[model samples]
Target: MKTFKKATDPNILKHVNALDNGEITTVSLKHIFHHGSSKYPNLFRRLDVTEENLRTQELASGTSFAYDVMGVNGTGFKYEKDNAVEEFRNISMNELKSSKLDWRDIGKWLPAIKNWGTLINLAKMTYNAYIEMGQEDWYDLGEEYSTNNTFGWEEDGIRGYVFASSDNKTLIISIKGTSMGFGAGPTVPRDKENDNLLFSCCCAKVDRTWTPVCDCYKGGYSCDKTCLQDSVDGESLYYGITLNLVNSIYHEYPNSHIWLTGHSLGGALSSLMGLTYNLPVVAFESPGERKAASLLHLPHPPAIPWDKMNIYHFGHTADPIYMGSCNGFSSSCYIGGYAMETKCHAGIACTFDTVSKLKWSVNIKRHRIQEIIDNILKVWWNLFKLFPDCKNDDECEDCGLWEYIE
Candidate 1:
């Protein structure tokens, strides 16, 4: 049986220290994840991203504990039917790649700029990501203002969607979050007849065929760096889609301001894609993990080219799903794995201080995208309603959800 451990416990403190050690980076993760594997095998097992193991954990937990895993893999796998439609005129832009963000300058500006309009746009995208819609749904979203969405592609192992403003100026690409499905991210092992090719992690890739440090899902995470590289390499499911999207977009949109957004694991993908595209991104409740060795050129925290790209992460400080805060809370072990050590390195955080109002108690409700959106909308309304013109105009025309007429 699992029991709660104090945050100060030596076993947990080491990881906490390592995560916040300032020196840690994706480069450092190469050492830490493998070297520290022995120390947190149990933690890794709990994080196993496979259908079978997650199913076991869900049954043991007596609830749906692996929803995030499902979101990442289900749609990704379901859509990879080799059906390649040339819908996206620019396949490169449609298939953007994923990269890590510059976390160093994230807080350089102090309190985040509360541009309600940007928040509303991000919130709408978050809603689209959460509800799992296609292009037509976005077109018929019933909003007065103009917004357009296009279905990208689901070939190889990539399943994502794209959208843009009415003028087709500020282009926004959104990836769907982890899907809820019967078989989450699972890999069918390569048998003698299978030639080492297998499907896992929401995409198709060659099996690492190495012994994992901890117990595993169908497709496993192991210390064999070479095999690991191949697992998520060019032929890897998600990255292939991302690469194609980037190639298409880079060639077509020579000067468009590209933006990316997603929630959960989708948020992770958005961050990766933003880095790959070197553009602005807004992510909701993303788990932190290491970039593949091939992306070593990506900059580390405290030294990012802010002028080139900007990233906004809106995770409630109390949400373990965003970062790890479960060391003291036994119930949150699955958050970013058992030790809850997964670390996110996105740009400046537009965080909500949920723990403060709750008297320092943690609640998962703060992690909900809709909940965050509701709060953002409220802040906008309160500020807009304070205007003398807005409040005094008793005969003002209804502006839909806006507090004042445009």
Candidate 2:
């Protein structure tokens, strides 16, 4: 368990606003998790934050904080899928081994959901992870003080960053989202595959002319439920890889408080991880993943109250993806080879009414993490001086028009 000391920089302090009139604390990049397209597909690298790797700057609220900006390299641990599966099965016992949603353990690992400040910090951390791929320093460009910590992996498979508080008490797992626009990246194929598999109803079967990612679509609006479940549980996919990552992290940091956050696809994966382990999650502008959770057969555990869960979705009305309005062949998501058909998110939604209150029109451009930070989250509270209440949407329905045939 490596730890870092609290060393605040005056320059960082000047740029950042005081959080609740107190100095903003920072988190350190402890490890980088990567899977697929390598000798060790499932790789974990441990790194320490040094002065050169550490950057401090202004962010949301009157709060300023620091984060590590280090290059990704080094091998710590390699994850073996067969062994992990065997171990998870043995531990699950009678519980759903495939889903890993042992309801008996629900609410046992809830994260400390303190206030909006905590959520804002988590969002910033998520942004840090998302922008690391571009390798451009937002702080250097005077776009507010945000750190860029490059963690390189093969253009294929899944990757995420592990950030820890100075005290080593809390750890935030930040997942990367879809990176396909303009030109295609190496991961675009797999990224699109996962998006279609996880977010779409019936393997992204929009119409007869469309090609389904999986053979779950029976015909018309009918889908084979068994086939859908099987496709979602494929070990090589992003969801399964994410489950493995969460399990590894849980064992590695048993005593530390762990939370998950991400934007877009990353956010949806974070929410799924939160459900699997009953940990805390804060997803930003993500399409609804509740329907995907159902297909994965995640535990609802009747005894657990919805309020007791620590999953939170933060987004606004402007983003069509977040609003569940982006679908059909003409929609941006569909045109981009994505079937973002789900819109019923799990847990509480802490959403801002940017369309109604701020009079912003719904648009796909607003789905970017930077847009959320600069236009909505950063400005919403500053102008209104209050946050929209986070509430449960258990009644929300997804894929209402489709039928899942058993």
* TM-score, structure 2 vs. true: 0.75
Q: How far is candidate 2 from the true structure (C-alpha RMSD, Å)?
A: 9.7
Question: Number of the top candidate by TM-score?
Answer: 2
lDDT of each: 0.37, 0.66
TM-score of 1: 0.48
Candidate 1's C-alpha runs over 4 A off are: 1-113, 130-158, 180-222, 289-297, 301-308, 326-340, 358-365, 376-406
Give the TM-scores of the predictions, in the order they appear. 0.48, 0.75
Q: Which stretches of candidate 2 lie over 4 Å from their true place?
A: 1-25, 37-51, 54-116, 131-153, 183-185, 301-303, 326-332
What clash count does candidate 1 reach?
A: 26
